[model samples]
Target: MALFLNTPKLNYWIPKLIEESEEELILIVPYIQTSKNVLNALNKADSNGVEITLVYRENKLSDYEKSKLLALKNINLLHHPNVHCKCYYNGDLLIVGSMNLYEYSEKNNREMGILMNRIRFKGQETFASRMVNDRTDVFDDAILEIREIINAASLEKASKKAKQTAFKIDIIKTEEDIVRDRCDRLNISFLNKKFRTVEYLDNKWFAQCENFFDKVDVVFQTHRIEITFRLEQNELYNLYRAWMQTYDLYEFHGFKYYWNKPDQELLVYKHDNFDWSTDNADCNKDKKYYEGLSTIIKKYRKITNK
Candidate 1:
């Protein structure tokens, strides 16, 4: 175990802690306001599939900071009303100290902390017993008891947050249900909504019915109708590509090639097509389009399981 005293340079160690995280990262800080470099590191850690749990006080995070933090895909932000513990830890290591993870603390304040090397007894003791601190090995049995106490505090905060999230999700689902119900009334099979854009996907193809970008269309228009088929599977895709090449086919359901790229590319397709213009009008045409697409999907599905 080592100690770092009056070290504003602790910001440098933050990145190291985040990078070294193997399974999970637990951070408890009262506030956070960090640089883009630090943010990028956190984003990179999230992209690596690390389970990150950040506990902080509410109202301490600014709107801009909150937006940036929320953008991370795999981070769980927990709000505690008066949390003051500034600790960063993972399964193998524990860093507990007076650091805010803020740019101001790194650049301005004198902070201090101790980094404890966790002792593990893999395959000998149970996973719970294996997690006891090296320094606290004398009271190894007490580790679980301490965790239980901490977990109760953490769970209380988590429950409150879960309620808020559940409420918001309920509102969103209710809105989607209402919209889907109305679309069903219009004799159209409604697809899932993503990014405020409603899509229809019953025909084994993707269709963008409405985009969040166009407010006028979202408010008044029932359907915007632009269908897309992803030639993602290999066998069926190869067959379809060969057929397209043989027939010199360019258009499908009044939609054209949105892109034509090489197979080596991650999103490459033999002939990717979608309709984005005036011709992709609602209801009857869309129904006809899906009906035509159903034949192709049936043919392809016969050859490949997908």
Candidate 2:
């Protein structure tokens, strides 16, 4: 038996549809300006872990409305541009209607709907495969159609939480991002290269070269960068010999050989500054050339025996 409903009945029964659901619910609404009672019922269903799938046309929604619905925890919301049919199902009952699940339609418009029992086969009445216009519009068929609609849509911002995943939207790069980028520009083996921070008194950034005692560390002071390295005395002489053969000590920043009496340690320092933005070409010469200071360091850092 099919029950015909006027606007007042639609207003009452839609929330009832959400309330009466035990296992699953599916709603396909084209313009979803759902009433407060309707939203409340859906929220209740979501809190109870009722599996729900909702399909609607995004072009008809306000920005706030779209965000409010997308914030729900358990409802799988989707968009389909070609759908205007309004369907509400709660496993056992199905309502197909001219009503849009819109508050204005329920309060003012002369809307109408038809509710029927969704039985697969009961005493020869097969509501699941109901015959209409020489075709079967099965209750299960709409479920499949909703699934297809979901599959066709991109899910990047579909919910920000389609499956309870944390999403980061900060596109701007940080100081750490810049440091890592410079490390990448160095001509070194990517698998063996690594960089990190040293948080002692003043925080500093350091890059490891193939797991050796000597490391390239950068200290950003105001706008100036103080590049430092620690190595043995013999390693410094070995590097300086090869470096002078091609370039001068000016390009080595301020490299020196500690030869006072019997000093043991070799420490190198270079002070410079540049535009720290993503314009890496201005900051560091990524290409092999006699262009930036970084290129000079990259060429000579590996020439030593240690």
Candidate 3:
């Protein structure tokens, strides 16, 4: 059987579906803004001991929205980075169409939805089991990684450029060296210059030595690290582009690039767009060049221990 409903008309069937659902409710929506109807439906489902899983895009959630969603015990608000489909699956029943959860989509915009009560399955297993098996945790570690990138981007946007170069550099001769000889050199230089202590993070030793190691500034990838200092806006961009050229790094598509003037920090990242072509020699050359360039920066920036 087929059923049709408009936005204002959703209230009629929505509550009925929630009341009848016994196993699970899977909601797939592209965008979710704050709305009373959506929240109320979710709350009702939660109170009924239904396992609610919402898959939506990973846009920044407002403080209010975060707080409201956090209060719900059973609601699972997940990030679906590639989610573009809109549908509702309640056990064996599947509703597919263009209708969104928003009031406008429901009440004003032209919308349509299909309600399928009995689905035919190709295998011996039931249709509900198949649908559940297709379910994925679209909001786990990937979301956390994306959040870290977003946080770093925010910091990059707010920092001011240094009036003078304040970055410390380090260099090592061999690729297998455990200790950062470059940082050791930087420590001596920093002591002589009396620059404030900056934390350093190192990968080779898997160690974070503070004050003892001249309080190394943040430790980073064994191959790449970032140091922030003040520079003119144009100078900063020039330096960044020069740095990129030092490695001949080609720009990745869809990556968001940002620079903070006050902090003199530049960040270029779009984890999703990164494509390291293992098959393409040119890409490898480009990658090697960039790695070499980072090595060069570390070599010169370090205050030589000798």
Candidate 4:
């Protein structure tokens, strides 16, 4: 059993534990916005058929985030509102810490924690079982119920509604028409779309998209126009790292990344502040905003694809 304290070790240790896993990978972080490399490692574990279970706080995850996580395979995602413990474990190791999966902690925060090798604890085999089979509180149960609803509903319906609401003007036929036409003109594959509003089904919606390198989506709302990259796991970390090295981070004001693992979004918004309430919104006026975003998306796609 070894302990890692304030050593920027999780970036190395977490992935190492994931890489060494043979059966399952469990991560329990209250808040998350992990780096791309770490996300890639998690995705790789999933691709290899590792049963990945994530226990996180529901309050911190957005609907867009919930939808993306529900899209993955061989993973069990549980949300507990009051959960603040950060515990990570696989078949052979257990890591618990003050660190979150958030990029801020991994990259910038002075966080501290401990990593224990389970094998060294020999006769105390119940340690892993206890961590895995821990009991859930009432909040956890409530989140599970909500999660079932979000995961079951298709994202297409949400996208259609967003399109209807955003492009309700007679000039547009359907949301799909605009998105499809734009994709066709750009020679990009139409993947999936996602939508969320404070009012709808606990603010959850999902859409299906093609598996392409281009993963960003143009999210149109009454008060804001956002170009968001919906990434699964480590793609954001990898891409963000590259973007930071190449682009001037300070210049892209509202452009940043957020992750809760399995559900990550890298986004830039036309407006930093938003009045998300329905009464304060005017989707009709955002035509020019959307056009500007389309141009940005096109350029971003080219840069990332290259």
Candidate 5:
């Protein structure tokens, strides 16, 4: 008898499918959204040279989402308007699932699915072969019909009116002005050679530094310290939290930390950049400042392995 059960925790089966898959993998999800984990899994399969065929609702894709999908070399995004089923097939193992391959559905939300193993039989062999042969032809015809509708709509005037509008602007500021105005306020050093070098080169590091500080509470001993920065996905926040807990240390100089929200603006520190002099002997006398700064730098360096 075939086993039937509620397939909650869909991610648990992905690794299994990935491991056992040999000849081909077919995924049919109506709504396709990209996430870091999903991309990683797909890339892993691609690295192993798995033949992946994806069918999704093309009309639902946003402009940015389409760009991301198009960037993948091996993955082909087929437009299937009538496709509402969420199914995964690896060889003879077929999985029908209620969960979409999205972050909320796969990670937090409660969802369910079912797994079925199809067997090959002598009498049904011809039927199965015919189904396999006709699969692409039938799916392609449906997809082409939808694409024609989309192309026709694109030529309409109202379609042009409904399109999203965007614009770009540039801001100019001098280094000395920025340091005097912003760094001095945050009590961060702005004079270090390293600080000046990293100020403008894709400040993702500064963003991560800010996030690290906000996610944890810290006590600082140093008045001034240099901090390095890097941008990482929000999912890695747990790893950072674990690292901080293990070390019992925090506080880094780079930027001000913000609240833990996806859309929250990054808090910029007044002392975002600083220049300190060794010749200033009186400034070095503050033991708390030196110790606190040293601790912050050391912890950051350890976390980044820099």
Candidate 6:
């Protein structure tokens, strides 16, 4: 059975939901302008070694909120553009509501929620509520829906310190990348267009291309690192668009651009200087590689309306 709750009760129980967690705390709430009490509860939960997963609206977090949230330990922050429901669950106890987890929503808005315990329900049977009757109304079904939402959300890395401590490991590869190499000669451009532009680098919009000009901004923080990663995809298109005015300068994404002297070349994509002798087998391999690469480049041009 689920206990109905109003605004005051919602505030009281949300913190309680977080505080009572012995292992994991999952909060799927959008627009997280957390009140002081709620923020303190989250901080304390982190101190106690509770694994917390918080999902909020994408690009909605201000730098202040980010600084505060990123400072915590044992917490995973995620972003979902579509998340609007408010749910707080600690494995067994669940709160489903018309809440935003925003400070004003709890203090001023007349919000409502239903508190449920999985322990109260026996087996796979769903307890019935007035005005609703179905398999979906069960407590287990609600849990499943929450899990689906979390699965669809993208993991957002918010820590500046983590980004500053750069990893020397570059490139995104699967067993597929390794297998393809076993069957063909490889180049930086091969993985460059094949992985970074065509598919998501890591199923996230942002991905650093494996080698080729990737290590240039090993020190520059801000958006420079992210922009340089994107330049791999941009530079590939620039090769045909004459966006380059000089070897050192280029335009990106329809904007006029220039290279910062401080942001000097960390890495630049250069084609193979291999001199090919026109033997029959060598000619065949060269043509095959060119055709394959040209196809990918053409497809990217179509997708980007270049």
Off by over 4 Å in 4: 120-306
**Candidate 6 error regions (>4 Å):** 120-137, 158-306
What C-alpha lDDT values do all the predictions have? 0.51, 0.56, 0.44, 0.51, 0.44, 0.55
Tally clashes: model 1.
0
lDDT winner between candidates 4 and 5: 4
Weakest 10 consecutive residues of candidate 4 by summed lDDT: 167-176
Write model 1 residue lDDT over 80-158, tens digit each, in one string. 6767878776655556779887877777787888665454323234322334355433222323432332344443223
Cand. 6 TM to true fold: 0.46
Candidate 5's displacement at residue 142, Å, is 17
Alpha-carbon RMSD to native, per candidate: 17.5, 23.0, 20.7, 22.0, 22.5, 21.1
Model 6 agreement with the true structure over 116-188: per-residue lDDT tens digits: 7643212233222222322223544666676677679887762332245331111112323333442243333
lDDT for each residue of candidate 5 in 133-184, tens digit (9 for 90 to 100):
2222233333344334333332212111123321100011122233333333
Q: Using Cα atoms with residue i matched to residue i, what is each candidate's TM-score against the true structure?
A: 0.43, 0.44, 0.36, 0.39, 0.36, 0.46
lDDT of 2 by residue, 211-299 (tens): 32245443333223344444567755665566556654344433322222212222333323433234345223233211333554566
- What TM-score does prediction 5 earn? 0.36
Steric clashes per prediction? 0, 0, 33, 12, 21, 3
Worst 10 residues of 1 by lDDT: 212-221
